[model samples]
Target chain A: MNRVNGDAVLGAAIVVASVLAVLVWVPRDTGSAIVEVVRGSMRIGDALAPTIGFSLLGIAGLILMIEARATGSTLRLDRFDLVFIAGVGGIFLCAMLLMRWSGPLAAALFSDESYRNLRGTLPWKYVGFIIGGGFMIGTLISLVDRRLTARVYLLGFVVALCLALVYDLPFGSLLLPPNGDV
Target chain B: MDYVLLGIQSVFSNTAMFSVFGVGIPSCLVTLFLGLLTGIAVGATPGLAGPTAMAVSLPILISVFGVRPDALLPVFGFLIGVMKGATVGGAVPAILFNVPGTPDAIMTTLDGHPMAKRGMPRRALRIAHFSSVTGDTASDIVLFVCAPFLAIMVERFLDLPEKTALIILSLTFISSVMGSSVGKGLIAVALGVLAATVATGQTFHPRLTLGIDGLQNGFPMVSAVLGALILGEIFVTLNDIWRGERQASTVQSSHGDVADGLQKGDLRRIMPHIARSSVIGTLIGALPGVGSTLAATLGYTVGRGIHKRRKRPEDPDFGEGAPEGIAATEAANSAVSGANLIPVLSLGIPGNAAAVFLILAADSIGGFNPGPAVFNFTRPQINPELVVAFGIFTLMALGNLLNWTIGGAFMRAMSVMSRIPIRLLLPIVLMVTLTAIYIQDTRMAALWITFGFGILGFFFRRLDIPVLPFVIAFILAGTLENTARQAFSATGGDPFFLFRSATSVIFLLMAVAIIVFLGRRKGHGAAATHPN
Candidate 1:
């Protein structure tokens, strides 16, 4: 199979998954809630609108896949391509995991009560961001440039610090991550 | 006439003018400079967008300014400056690194990269800057003149059914024209609407959340946009860099100086292209949902057609480092920045993402609620919203002036700004994106939504799907639903209510015609070019 065809297959698979999730899984799980909230005013047609939309989207994806398969625009990924994908995916995964677990991790590291205090836990939260963000960025830079340097790490650290500080400003009464209460 | 006079008077009203930092600096001027500088910085950076910059700053600015009447102009001044500044700034990366900061600048890279390769990078930058400022100024004038009139017309003729049909027509037309395949474009719009349907407005039970508490308010607009547009693009770039298909190269290695400005002959040659493109940009901008990317693409095509018709031996080859090519794309895209406000101010329908954010700010800040109500002439009482809108127009004018005078120099300096490797830059961008979303929504769940949507965006882009239709659809989803529901209920659930209205029927037919015509044209083009 060519690359374009491969890409189309992957896209079709995604659309199919989305269609099931939107049309079936979500509706089944939440339909009762919707019925209760709308007081049964929600018509079958209204409820089915989004499902129809996703179904159409799936058909469109299928068309694109068939066209790509016919055209035969294909390519193969080399080692670097895999690494790049992994790097980005890894970063996203890591960041999501960090944001998710940092609160619980903080609670475990300290007392639950202490971890609950946002002002007190902010420094530790910053540390988590800096270390995690710096390490991933540094690794990616080293891999791409074929050399490790302090500049990328230093820049990452400074950027993370600035981001944390700006977000923590008193303007909106906003706080950075590890914001368990919010 | 009185409204026009009030708008002009409000531009200089003391109520809107204030000092910054307890210094004598005017608040409007200070905010304009700061917003423009931030906009230029963000726009010069690849993988960032104007709306992203606006989104990042919006909540913070709202918090700082509060929703007080006195705070309206300062907050909106900054946002308006950013909107205009970013359009001019996006050209910097396109000219310097062959990497467009915004999708609208993709056309710029064609002739711009070649010009830079020929060691006239500064010349290209000048052409871009000159055309952008000129186009922006001209479009702003058009917006100033036409928006109120359009708003009055819409108010008079468009009932709920007609309005809803108009939106549907816009969605259909935009989806049809954006991508190579109509199916893919419509699919993108559908998916966008689906994404938006989650935790959205409905009369019945909360829909599509799957019982998740965090999904109740739906995906935060900032998170969705940043994830899908900014972070997703970064992911694509990472893969390209890894595949050895692209490099994190800077323009510092290319020697150029801004002291070499555009010659009179160069200006004369590109003048027609700039003029024609600005008009095209303004016209398209007035249409709801069509964006700068389309404007830029159409402008370049039309300019090329014009150049071909008036072919002269001295004319630069249309695609071979032509100054006119740069002018056409830059002017059209920049013109879109101002003209986009037309629909927003007149009809309260945001024409593009930037205008969406502009409306968001105005809505949140409590002073300017855009629509025909803004243009409402209340005797013995001035409309504050109208005044605020005028104030924003004044700030936009100031921004254009600054862009004309110093935009080239700013872009020149940015040509070598931040030699930070993409590997490093991407991660920082990631951090900023996360921080911005987290601050705005204050929820870890929002971050997850962003990441998930980022992945979705990466895949969509990978399969050559257009993202704009999806974005426009998502942003307008709530409006679409509410309008349609209102129209239906107003007609007592009559299925043919839309057909009963002449305007609604016309709009729906136009939508169908657009789909059929564009789809057939696309098929013919594909057959001619890529016969199997």
Candidate 2:
């Protein structure tokens, strides 16, 4: 049996993806022709650049696979990498969701008006960012420290608050996080 | 001559003044100082880099001073200040903690740590500072003299087809030189081009956006770039920390108390090394995609050879508390900062990540376009872009002046930053970066796109694919497509428009030759290693 290294596996995956992008995705997504005549002058279309890029990508992938097969160079992607990515990604998604929702939730629970009306106000604008940003920082720190402490959470909130003030103090026009969305 | 005067005048003009101690100071100068201070702190931090600081600060700078023409100088001044200060500050950690703050500082650790242990830390630091400032000033002088002339030549000679071909050559060169393998680099460039195609500019129809409304307008340039370069790095660092792949250095080297100031005789001894290394660094930096690490290695090797031949019985050997070694490495790496701007200011091509941020700033601000046309002196009218270019040069000069005067003191003060844990700092950086991006874009979709690109960047790093090629290619894709389209139309629908001119044909042929020659050489080496 012949042994295949991780570079070969990665290259083969890239080749497959590139082929799909060129044949399936590009045609389906791009609405314009590769060459179009506009006002009686021939011009390169929207699709040509991407088509060329994907084709080159495919060729490069093939070359990479061939070279990797010859070289037997290994690329390490262990289970730990997957878990770390997933964990970090989960934290990011949760933080974003909290950032998106905290302001609206605050307005619904505390204020008579919608988040849209209260977004430009002082305390209301600071709510979502402090909650979400603080949570992200604190949780990440805890993840690193292997233990969650109240001091970490407090530090996170303080840092988030400081960041908010830093942006909000001088710049009247600038909106912080969920406030802009609201 | 008029434009030069105008540019100098623009930088010093009373526009955008801030009051300090009942006296008016130029805001740009103030921002430049602040940026220098921030850069020193960032550089002294072990895992932080200049590009990361620039990436996080750019959107904030833009938001603070809108995108007006007046904002260009202040913004550029800050970025340039950071670039200059970071170069000087990177040696601090290498000297004090035996940890290189930046990649180029890897060479500095060889002799610097030894000098510190020998109770000459201050002397080693002085040598590094003097060498760094001198090399930086020398390279800045080269940039000042050479960039305009190169731009003039490119303007006079290269047409659209030739320009297109030049960009193609640059992309090919960057891909070939950057990563472990040319094929991987090419893949990175191709992916960058593909990512750039999602933007709805330069064509009648939106292309490759997958019917997403947020992507219809395109991924925010700042967000995508910051995500790929900065956030991606953070992700990888965090993962390493999580998986116990990275560990903090617990060994503490005591700073011995001794008279460690650089004596006048020491300066004379290291001067030749500094001079030679600065020249080597300047030449290497001018090439696209080649960076300071190579310059540092070459400088150290050459300096060691020269030192060996001229060795005195009393003098310390190279890499063993040798002041000349510190001078050579610091000078070489620091020199790259100024000469790296040659491609950026003249050809509108960024050779490295720092140059990429500068290009991004100019692109976002929209008053200046960097290219051959920037130096079109034929026009009787005052060229604003030319003046802005000179303003940038003036800012760089001012940055060097600051570095010469106060950069050493500031850098030494920032050594405390190295003690901060990377695991703690990176997450905070991630938050700050996300916030900065959010404030500029004011859209959730932009953050999502940034995260997605950050993931892609992580994969690129993990797979040993170079990110600089991808970034340079992404930035250049629009320009290349626009130039190609114009050339194709101008040549009466000729499909072979890239080969229409001799210069362009040569450029195209060079691009192909580089790929073929380098790729085959790499293949032969691989085949030799793995004989079946």
Candidate 3:
């Protein structure tokens, strides 16, 4: 109950703060702040009004939501199961981000030229495979079934090989850009 | 004394900041274009960042037009103008192609892509592009106030370790706020730091050059950035294309209605997060190397946390197409472009990747080094330069404001891309990947790096790693490490010198405290299930 009340109070406070800032503080510096004169700045004295006006307009929306909450609307949330996912996301996200900066990791793993070439290659086919394979493997054996895991492993390897052969299969044939196109 | 006044005049004497007023004119053009076309073509091509459009064209002004120093103002003014154009243009492809034009386009993908698939690509593209530009322009003004105001304080901050520690705190913040786990964020950072160590030897000799002459001077910044970040994105696209079975292009229908367009109700709901995102972007962007990505995440996270502490009845949509998501992302990403300069002007540190490139250019001209001395000596002394900065900032603000009101409409035109089969899209991404990297130097080695990072990135994404902190750490590690080394030499290699400053002490404590707090959350099962 206290938590609920606290949440409500905070919501009210946000709304109140928005209101106060818009009503009192905004007008005092209306002329001085940067946002003024954005709209119709084709002329002088026309800029500041729109900037502050829109800001307050935005604030008004928040206030309405707060008042409506006396009925029963709250920001949607997934239980703890989902919110915490953001944490794990941070990990994998960071890993990929760091990998770009990791010249050592790249050099250790692959040739520099080939590595540079790979960035542009993500196609729908790959997305299809991941999504399709996930669905197929997921459906065929619940993904965790012992037999399914081996099949998925085999399937992935085979697909990877085919991809290497098909798209990355090199051709010495060269043609210059046609002058008309160029 | 007269010099200062003259410099100030150069900046503002253009008919009472009218030059600044002229800058916003581009935004009006961009926003209007967004409205008219409802989309832009070719911006979604991989490796083209919002700033790249300007970077590539910068030389044309010099070589073709024979621009003098006086012409630099109008030239950069045009580039800044182009940046505003690109920010809105970037959204078109992001909505249509799922591939983003800039990192800021990443947010547009969440709902915009979905809307495109539903055949309302036009509406989604227009609305999102509109919302994005609006939010972007709004934040630019926020930075106009916030960065200079913060500079007054950041300029006074004298502790090296504290600055380092603050960066650590920011890294920690990135990890915690990522959709994955802190462990992953940390692992990524470690990996990034390790990556930065390559080819950097003690002094006379470059390490890990490994017999490559080009590498002896270290990876060229363009190649490295292009290779790791850009190519990596492309390779992943190719990998996806290869793995998939969907070979046909998708045919999407158009969904349009005035009521379906963003209603006042939509804008009303998104305001708070918009405000919050603007503030966070302004604050973080003022620091160097912590660019739009961190600002983006910070804004995104504030929205995420808002869900946890929901006050507004409309909070549930926070992550989805909720205006807050769009608002936060647009505001934060755009604002950071301005904020990232604070460090460049106040300190010599380049705040983000684009700034680093600019710094290299500025340095070649015997410009004052980017530190306190620059402010005192280099700043007020240059009459025209001050004019340039002021014109740039004020004009950029105008450009952004104009972007907000109408630029998104231009992006909506890209809905035609949905007509392409998904299969073709995937393979095209691959082909484009090959062509782009090859153009960097016809080096095949970059391809393999792209492939490797793609797989690595895939694995990291699969495992839920926070990519941003790792990227940031990678960018900053060399500088941070070098700074620490210099400070050490300044104190005769005493390791304790890092700890000697009271400012350092305070930053260290703050870093420790933040890590402990965030770390404890890790210790609990709070993040166990997600385990990125």
1 against 3, candidate with superior TM-score: 1
The C-alpha RMSD in Å for every predicted model, in order, reads 4.2, 2.0, 18.8
DockQ of 2: 0.62
- What is chain B's TM-score across the candidates, in the order shown? 0.89, 0.96, 0.67
lDDT of each: 0.73, 0.86, 0.46
Residue lDDT tens for model 2, B3-121: 88888888888365677687768778888998898888888888899998998899899997789988899899889988988888889889988988888999999999999988888
Query: How would the docking of model 2 be graded?
Result: medium
Docking class of 1: acceptable
| TM-score quality measure for candidate 1 | 0.86
- For B1-532, candidate 3 gives per-residue lDDT tens digits of 4444554343333322123546532332232233222223334433345444433333333332233444433344444555556555666555656666666668766656665565555555555555456555665665455444454455577545555555555445544445323434455555555455545635343443445664555543334443344434433333333334222334234344433555556666667776777678777776543557677777887776775577466444544445556566766676666666666555445555545544433432232344434333254346344444444465565556555554554445444544543332332333344333433334444434544454445444433454445555555556666565445445554547657878777766765675556555544443243232
Ordering by lDDT: 2, 1, 3
lDDT (0-100) at residue B408 of candidate 1?
67
Task: List ranges where model 2 is wrong by over 4 Å.
Answer: A1-4, B14-16, B19-23, B201-204, B248-253, B521-532
Model 1 chain B: ten consecutive residues of lowest lDDT: B10-19
Better of 1 and 2 by DockQ: 2
Query: What residue pairs clash in candidate 2, if any at all?
Result: none
Comparing candidate 1 with candidate 2, which one achieves the higher TM-score?
A: 2
Q: Evaluated with TM-score, which candidate comes out highest?
A: 2
TM-score of each: 0.86, 0.96, 0.55
Native contact fraction of candidate 2?
Answer: 0.65
CA error at residue B314 for candidate 1, angstroms? 5.9
